[model samples]
Target: MTVETPPERPPLTSVDQVNLSDWDFWARPMADRERAFALLRERETPVFFAEPVVTYATPGEGYHAIVRHADVLAISRRPDVFSSGQGGATNIPDMPPEFTEYFGSMINMDDPRHARLRRIVSRAFTPKMIQKFEDDVRVAAAKIVDDLLETGPGCDFVTEVAARLPLKIICDMMGIPERDYRFVFDRSNIILGASDTEYVPADSVDGIVGALLTAGMELQQLVQDLAAHREANPTGDLISSLVNANIDGERLTMQELGSFFILLVVAGNETTRNAISHGLHLLTREPEQKARWLADVDGLAPTAVEEIVRLASPVNYMRRKVTQDIELNGTRYRAGEKAVMFYWSANRDRAVFADPDRFDITRHPNPHVGFGGPGPHFCLGAHLARREITVMFRELLTRVPRIEAGRPERLFSNFINGIKHLPCDF
Candidate 1:
């Protein structure tokens, strides 16, 4: 297929144009390293690969990295040129076959197909639906804060509170059994583990991938059963809604249903979990900012959301392949080459964000790419994710007056940046 081509980007310095090989494409480390590198890239070159030898392929080959704020915003707006269909699944590939196949199911699809699937469930995630979640979010936040107080100070908040609340809510929304909450959480780690190292234990690389496959397989069976259940016993939950949801005069097929179910579970669970963890980390790190936010709960909630999303960027960078030979930023065009957009870099562009490295909670008129770019491929669940974090912070500040990060742990995957152990003393 001849791919739509983006106009040639402006020329870059020799240092900025160094080729990045496959193995060198994504160098996963701690959260701090990513922050530093992102700042550096924005300073030197707005768009460049993570390593030399830009043309190499363990999967997709030869791709450019878009880190500048303007470029990301521009590309995100024009879905036709920077379309996410086909390989637009996410930058990091090589997870489970089921997940890969499921990516092709809908969300990553471009144009008519994406619009078709999205419109089907768009009602379920509409403004009203998002607003209605406040009650659930409040209850969940209260439960977590209460649980933390009952346990007292010195706890890994990410495990005890941050990740679980959203995971639980998302599972509840998807009609997943409570017993399987941890299973869904575990699988989500592997699926989005593209950028962190926590997913890969020492000498246990395959473990992550295995968990992903197993989870995807189990989710498939569970969804199959749920669809059957919905058929017999309809309810008002998302699963039931999806069961009856139709697009283009046709209901979703078995696989499409399964993919939607799994994506909702993974997307909602993982992204919100990171936002909560990162938000707490940011607040605890900056007591003054946290206090200000606490004082102005109603006003600071949105800013807090943007700060955390921009700071965390939980999903990390997604990869895209060039369908045909094309030149980009003075580079020669070559067919079947691979390139990617490193969102980690885009959110920190110096030109867009003042003092890009500093975590500012009250950043005015923030235009961060925490929710991806504009147009058709923008994140649908951003509303829910932001709401969950805001509620958690509002409740958390009420319960815990002072907080500090005790000990922190990050994920092993290079794509989904997250914290495995965020010990916080409150």
Candidate 2:
């Protein structure tokens, strides 16, 4: 896909120019987005904006744009007052009943239900299992690099390099067959890229919602079939373990399994994919940093991976419903209201990170909320994502030490800071 030139936006001279609800706001240049959020972060109280209208769901009361690092951390810690389940954490607008069946999972839930699901899933991510995944990540990264070398450069880095490792790792963990990899990849792109015209026509709300639901249903059906088979004849894969294991007399229902799988694949795939893509671009732009990392690839891998995620902030914002009237960080929020935590902005908060815009791999004490804030909703796959990034970059820098990224074709959506395509050369 071609990278569409972003329409010229007037300089963000005033906070009034910043509207988090505007679709056009998201499509603006990256520099403009940074300026817009910086303006929002300067305000004493969070700015409230009317919810974006959609045909599938009614627009509720406007949501506060939580841009500061401290506020994001505070609201995350107080899950009792700010709930993820009243409507959903994934979207600003209330998730309609129909959307919940496939989209709803532990991420959009509160305690008891969230705890139960988390507990069940956590059992599968045991130390031994994680070690196994790490081993697989190394092998997968190497294979991906091997293919990239054979194909040579001038390829879309997002697809050729960044998207491959996470997609393969997630699919393998779920016991998805090799033949079905493309099927899963396409569906996930639709689910997350529905707002982008390349994936779904932006003709109407009906078209967007239809594409999303169809992708979700197709994914759920695929998992259900695999889960049914796993139930009868278990294997060493995660699907088999989830299907047969009993955790404190609790088991994930087929619907829960399907939704969780959808969450795992999409969340796991997209976040790491975007991070890797952004990492390449960051390294390319800051060649000195790349040289610094290349001097000691193994030593700097951990810090480099983190710095990339902090800057990438792939899954941009998560919405929460105010459960009670409360005062947090000198701002009062009424009960039955909504607050959207912009992780991307929080990561760039000046109060937290010194020289936040600079790509410093050795950025110590990096308290970035790229993986969500400190709460129960913190990303379950964060460890895996870090591992995937570290391994992928290690392989890339070691093999093709001079690789550089070209202009990126970014996704046109507010939800995810994604690069649909990025050219590369070595």
Candidate 3:
């Protein structure tokens, strides 16, 4: 297969036209990321960034980087044209069939198939299930804060607090035994943080891929064993619900179940953890906003969560393949071409948001594509994520009002906007 960047025939207008495909760009500190995106936004709203070739898989011609809010929304709304099932959701090039099918969840499937899988999974998130989840979230949040209080505030907030609530809740929902909590957490970190040397050694591209696959397989095996047990004996948990769930006598195949489990483990656990981590860091950076939030967390929390997600954009960009020749604005894209929706940029688009860079908890009419734009592929756990953040912050601020967070140790990957470690003191 050919590996190349889109043919560029435009004069350079800015010095910051750095290729986003460079791993160094993603590994940069958060402050540098802002400057990079700002430069890209100024030079071109939607520009193409060629992906670098890798040892394990060859990245095909790179994707169109859609930065404008309108363009991201337009593409998201038209799944028929921009199909996730065509290309893997991540900006990275194609992987082996086993890896793709085993790792990709419903988010990677187009309609019909996507609808079928989503419908079954949707059954697991009924109103009753959600209420129970909320109750669990409140309890988990309280316990997490209580533990932090006992620890007397000087701790890695990312590991101790931000990662606690969601990981516990997700594990409990899956009926994972308490003994396996640490195992689940470790595997998740390895899966998402493989690109970071702190999580997995930065030995080589193949080594990194090996570690990721090993982590994924370990988690996949765990779920498979659990699914087998659940088959023989049903339980009152989301895993059981998914295991027994059927639509028109359709049930999730073992592979689908495994993929779904991985999705929940990675997406369900990682996204909220990163969001909570960023929330605390943001509050620490802007004490005025923190004070405002403390004043009325309940009244302002609904919008506050939106703002956090808008700013955090934990899952940065998702890839889609063009199904047919189409012209987006003035750029012509052919069939099989790729487009990456930069949620991090779209959330900061000046055209849609006034003072888009400002962190305002009271920002209303927030049409940010933080949870992704309105489309069939919109985040499935968005409601749960919001509730988790709201309740977790409410508990933290109410109990540890003087909490202070240090600079975040960001993850070294373009895929997830993650914080590996965050020091905090109250």
Candidate 4:
């Protein structure tokens, strides 16, 4: 299985040379993306581009490319004005009704609906709940490392190591049996990596949307079946808690549970895996930074995990819709307009961090919005994500300190800055 390298792109000398909505833009090298975003940030106001046409839905009006840190922060904080519910925060086009059936969770909703759903689900992600899983995370990471060692070097790190921890943790939290782990994993790949030929084959029967819907339906069914069982014979797992009703007597409907499960597995699994993969790649590229972290893995794990996330910006840009005519940092956005908050670009903005492109683990006051911006829609699984990254790296560096990542097989998706495969050796 050979990886096809993307063709060389011309240097982005001007903002006009770039198109945020183009699929080819995302296929460009990371340096080219950096330069292209830098040119956009140089402009006084956000640049607008036409929406990418998808087979599943019609492209709405183009969106403003909100690339700067301040602008992203402003838009994220003002959820009332910049709504995720109008269309959906995950994609540029208004989510088609079919897409929403499987994909529409709280992240795609507004208050009081968003707030209500979040309130119900937030219990599972509380500090106490996350702490309960801390031992499980350690045991999981150790076993993964043990397998990596037994398998020896030249393994696909993304699959053998990075992808396993998050997948297992999320599944375990939901009471998914070990027999169904691969079932959940494959479907997640299709849902997020649909554009990549590796996951949803280009020669498939129904194409991207069909593959997505099929995958979504499979995952929803798996969770629904589990939810039905959990409801009757309740367990301490998240699925049981969600299905049974909280102290407030609020419980998720079957449809809500299905959508939320999809969101949880997809978002929770994919983002953290990419972050871990990117962290290893970053450390490999910057050996000095790697050594710096190695010098004090336990002490610097928090900052190191954060810096990796900041640089990786795993989930990339999230789209928001303007609810009213609003002026943010002198740029005016009209009602019903779309604003794509490029968290990846904002993480590299010069205004906020000194030498923003540098991957320094000691980056103090690291206020990067890798987990989306600070608002109601901020990443629900953030604490778990941080813990996962930290534990995985700690286990790796302490046990396999010399491990290094080879060339990454990057995922060809604008929404996710993902490495589908990463070769590793020590």
The most accurate candidate by lDDT is 4
Global local distance difference test of model 3? 0.83
TM-score of 1: 0.85
Better of 1 and 3 by TM-score: 3
User: Tens-digit lDDT track for model 1 on 8-48?
Assistant: 43333344343333332233234435544554464543333
Off by over 4 Å in 1: 1-57, 92-99, 194-209, 323-335
What TM-score does prediction 3 earn?
Answer: 0.94
Q: Which pairs of residues have clashing backbones in candidate 2?
A: none
Instruction: Give the Cα lDDT of each candidate.
Output: 0.68, 0.91, 0.83, 0.92
Models ranked on TM-score: 4, 2, 3, 1
TM-score of candidate 4 on Cα atoms, chains taken together: 0.98
- Candidate 3 residue spans exceeding 4 A from truth: 1-16, 43-45, 126-128, 204-206
- Any residue pairs clashing in model 3, and if so which? none
Tens-digit lDDT string for candidate 4 (55-74): 77899879999999999999
Write out the backbone clash pairs for model 4.
none
User: How many residue pairs clash in all the candidates, one count each?
Assistant: 33, 0, 0, 0
| Candidate 3 clash figure, as a count | 0
Q: Per-residue CA lDDT of candidate 2, range 275-339, in tens? A: 99999999999999999999999999988889999999999999999988999999999999999
Winner by lDDT between candidate 2 and candidate 1: 2
lDDT (10s digit) by residue, model 3, range 137-242: 8989999988998988679999999998889998999999989989999989988877677677655555767777888888888888998999879999877887
